[model samples]
Target chain A: MKKAVFIKEGQVAIKDAPMPEIIEQDDAVIRVVRTCVCGSDLWAYRGDDAKEAGSDNSGHEIIGIVEKVGAAINTVKAGDFVIAPFTHGCGHCAACRAGFEGGCQSHSAATNFSNGYQAEYVRYTHADWSLVKIPGQPDDYSEGMLKSFLALADVMPTGYHAARVANVKAGDTVAVVGDGAVGLCAVIAAKLRGAKRIIIMSRHEDRQQLALEFGATDVVAERGEEGIAKVLELTNGDGVDAALECVGTHLSTETAIAIARPGAVVGRVGVPHTGDINVGDYFMKNTIFAGGPASVTTYDKAVLLKAVLDGDINPGKVFTQTYKLSDIDQAYKDMQERKTIKAMITID
Target chain B: MKKAVFIKEGQVAIKDAPMPEIIEQDDAVIRVVRTCVCGSDLWAYRGDDAKEAGSDNSGHEIIGIVEKVGAAINTVKAGDFVIAPFTHGCGHCAACRAGFEGGCQSHSAATNFSNGYQAEYVRYTHADWSLVKIPGQPDDYSEGMLKSFLALADVMPTGYHAARVANVKAGDTVAVVGDGAVGLCAVIAAKLRGAKRIIIMSRHEDRQQLALEFGATDVVAERGEEGIAKVLELTNGDGVDAALECVGTHLSTETAIAIARPGAVVGRVGVPHTGDINVGDYFMKNTIFAGGPASVTTYDKAVLLKAVLDGDINPGKVFTQTYKLSDIDQAYKDMQERKTIKAMITID
Candidate 1:
């Protein structure tokens, strides 16, 4: 089987790898149908993540068909269409039972001992707790519908998590800091959550257009203090009720904090690259900083699926570029070059 | 008039100062009936806050009798017994209207261009917005009642703020990191908010006794990782639903985060001395970090006043040592030496 491998800094290639098999009682073998490059992947691709330059599995977001299920797996069966969250969890753990599968006791994202999903076949452990089965058959969904469903595995749910943790409510004024696919999805999530005014910070015209289409009431094209000034101006100097830090940089987090109103919450879903935060400023403003990794299992994926199926949201629009499995290297180049918001990979 | 001055890094003294008078239309001249040394005051006393080594008015917490009111003052008048929140605000500002007076547009804690409360007579700006009147005449309350009311100025309200921001609810298990008066008050606040179990981390037997008396179900005598381990063990390794960070150090904040359950909130009211936070660990746990300087003006001071008046809580008990106005230096020394939980200063 062919899988994406991290060749070295600024390079990636396709290589033949051993086929994955079910090794645990709750494990399952899945044939990858669709996957994508996450912003976090850029860390390793740039050699900044300290990952040795070698052949290693990449990509965590995946939509696939269960080719085989372990005998212990009861909730899902072979031939089922499934969506795997970015992180896996053991079903019966206290954290999982409390609806925070991201903090699963036995199995978590840190202990991803299995192979990545950027391959033809992958082994998934704790299948009963980690995989969410799609209700309908593959024949019942269109190509776009399948792509949108794939977002439930990571980005879309992550955006929703940002809104949920920020306690975004009806009539709230929200600001999304970043123009990437996740930030755009946050605008949609805020809108879906009933935010009355959505402000998006974007520099690109194309991303701005998508943001507006996704329900951003306004867009601030500036960066740093100027961007915060624009948001405060839009909010009549009071700042937004909620701010979503979609870009993991310190500047973005600072901007999010700057534009949040007193008692407002700044929800960050971006993988933070910056270490320290200006806690002193945060204290004086009386703002609440919330959010981290999205607990996809805790989110109401079923409701989101219904919303997608009913044509309420088209998150697939974020897939500005697409590529066949053989052209995975080109996909990475396009994403790294900023030519695409997100690169959709077709593995089947 | 006389007032407490920050003469040097390790010293405080009572010195003659000018008599205060109303300067702004909404200002008031109040005769400070009582005042106290706050835990944060030690920051400046210890030379950690970089305050100039010269005479500058000190304390912020005060209960007083209105001596005179400006023409624009409507909510309060001369002869009214009142308590001033630690921070002031323009009641009409967006932040003030939203119940976050600490972030008021025209007024904030930093712009204390006005005089401090540690004086015989001090001018107060935004009198109508900053002062909350006691229900009855000054003569009707006992010495303990007045001290408890003074606690509402900062410590009690700040503790309550921690629990409030953490979203402490009925049946929740809470852990308070710190054994100071504010931390003990947080234990009381958590109990009042209906927390089923309250855990307080304290090394001092006196503080632990106060914590237990204030409704702490368990007291962990350990510090740092050991303290967190004790809390985790007490919670059956599930961790507490809410953790109040009453100590403003990195170790305290880390311990608070470590003992928090997934989806839990760590509410911090301490003036944070530790700069950066471990965003990576925070993200992996799916925890929410919320809180800042407690908006004392946002709290329902009337409820706290009533509780004190009715003998429901004895926050005054935390003031184990008392001194007359002329003995202000002794008060500061006792607090500086950690020989007292808090110091009470009688101005009359």
Candidate 2:
């Protein structure tokens, strides 16, 4: 089997690795069909966040075919095509029961994939609850449907988490604070939740166009104070009813908070990497700040899978570029240099 | 007429002031029947918060009789007994319509009281919406009922706001940080919302006893880390489902956040006076932080008034001492020295 490895900052390589096998009673081994590079993965690739050199298991999202299952794995079995949520859970834990599988308490590690899904084969622990079986094999679905199914593993669900936490409702005016794939997905999420007006902040023309296509009603190219001013102006100086913060930076977070109307919520889904947050500002407006890692398993089972199957949302459009497992390095490079919105990788 | 004035740190004076008249068509003049000292008022009294010397509008809460009304004040008129919420609103602005009167726009100031409620006569702005009419005159209710009506003006509703923001549900576990009048009221708020276990932090035996009487099931005397540990231990390490922050200090806020379970909300109603909040901690737990000044007008008209009128709650018990208007200085002194939980002033 071959897997992606992080050699150092700005460098990734696909190297031969041992084949994955079920090691626990609840485990299952799957042959990877599709995987992708995440914006979060870029944190380490760009040297902004540290990762040990020569580390494998470089990616988390996976749409694969289950090849084998341990004794206790009853929900999914061999020959089943599945979507594996990046964050796994036991489904029965208190947190999971409450729809927060990312904080599942019964698992030793919420995510238990051997050698990462960015490989020819991967082992998933607590397989019964972590993997969502598709109605048919990969061969039965169109290429576009397959891409949308792949998105359900993380990005689409993560973006939906922001809208859900913000309680974006019908007739709401929503503001999205990033132009990344997750932000574009959030535009869809906001629209799905019936938000009447969606304003997206995006400097890149291609990303802005995708956001508009994803249901964003307006676009503000400005950043920081100017961006907040632009959003407030768009909303007639009343600020947005809900703000989705998909960028994990102080300025982005600040802009999200600043553009939210009094008594509105700001749902932040970006992995935080910012300085002190002035809670006083949130306090004054009675703004509710809610969010964290996406509950991928819950959302995938409840909404995203159905939405994708029905072709109600085309989240796969976020993938502007594609590659094979052998070309993993160039995939990372293209995403890192802003040459592509996202990279989709296919493995055989 | 006599009104209380801030003389300096640790001092208050009852001085003769001019009679208040309705300046705006939306204003009304009331003969203050009962008023009280608040925990927030203590900030300026202790010199921790700045206030201009000799400021005469030294208080906000009031239970009074409408003695005069401007042309536009139709809902409340002369001879009506009313509860004047400290935070006034026009009742029709977007923020007010959404039940956040503290952020009400269209008014020059959300609070519009002349010469303070502690005076013999107080003028209220946006009178039609700011005043909740009692069924009968002051003479019709007992002293305890009047005290509770005054409590509805601020502390009771403010504490209820904490519980409301946290979304306390049936069978939930709630932890309250702060044991002042507002915190004590939060215990009642939590119980009213059907919390199964209500834990309150209080070192004072007097406050602890009152909290228990009000519906708190557990008491943690420790502060800071120990307090958080004690709460976690009580909940079997799962932490409380809702944490109500009633004390506006960094340590109090930190304690509230630390004892909340994953996906829980920390409802903060304390007037914030702290440094940067570590939003990263909140992010890791998917905790939602929401709150601001209580929507007293909304709560008073919708719930607190009926609750008090029906004798369903006795929030007035928080007022442990009584004083005549002439003893305004003594009221501040006793409250400052911790000799009283709250001071109830009678104007004759």
Best-fitting candidate, scored by lDDT: 2
Clashes in predicted model 2:
0
Q: Give per-residue CA lDDT, model 1, range A1-348, as digits (tens).
A: 988888777777788888888888888888888888877777778667766656664588888889998888998888899887776767566677766677777775655323467888888877877788888666678989888888878888889878988989999999999988889889989999999999999999999999999999999999999999999999889898899999888899889988988888888888776567755457767788777767675564546777887899989889888898888878888898899999999974
* B1-348: candidate 1 lDDT, tens digit per residue: 988888777787888888888888888888988888887777778887777654564578888889999999998989999988777777677677766777787765665223467778888888777788888766888888888888888899889989998999999899999999899899989998899999999999999999999999999999888888888899888899899999989889888889998778989988887667755457667778777766676574536777777888888888999888888878887998989999999885
Which segments of candidate 2 are over 4 A away from where they belong? A108-115, B50-52, B108-115
What are the per-residue Cα lDDT tens digits for candidate 2 across B104-125?
7666554543235789998888
Report the TM-score of candidate 1, chain B only. 0.95
Q: What range of 10 consecutive residues in model 1 chain B has the weakest lDDT sum? A: B107-116
Per-residue lDDT tens digits of candidate 2, residues A1-348?
898989899998888888887788988898889999998888789997788977864588889999999999889889999998887778876567767777666765535322356888888888888789889889999888888988988899989999998989999899999999999999999999999999999999999999999999999999988888888888777788889999988888888888987788889999887688867666867888999878888888888899999989999999888899999989999999999998999984
Model 2 DockQ reads: 0.59
Q: Show pairs that collide, candidate 1.
A: none
What is each candidate's DockQ, to 2 decimals? Answer: 0.53, 0.59
The candidate that wins on DockQ is: 2
TM-score of chain A of each: 0.95, 0.97
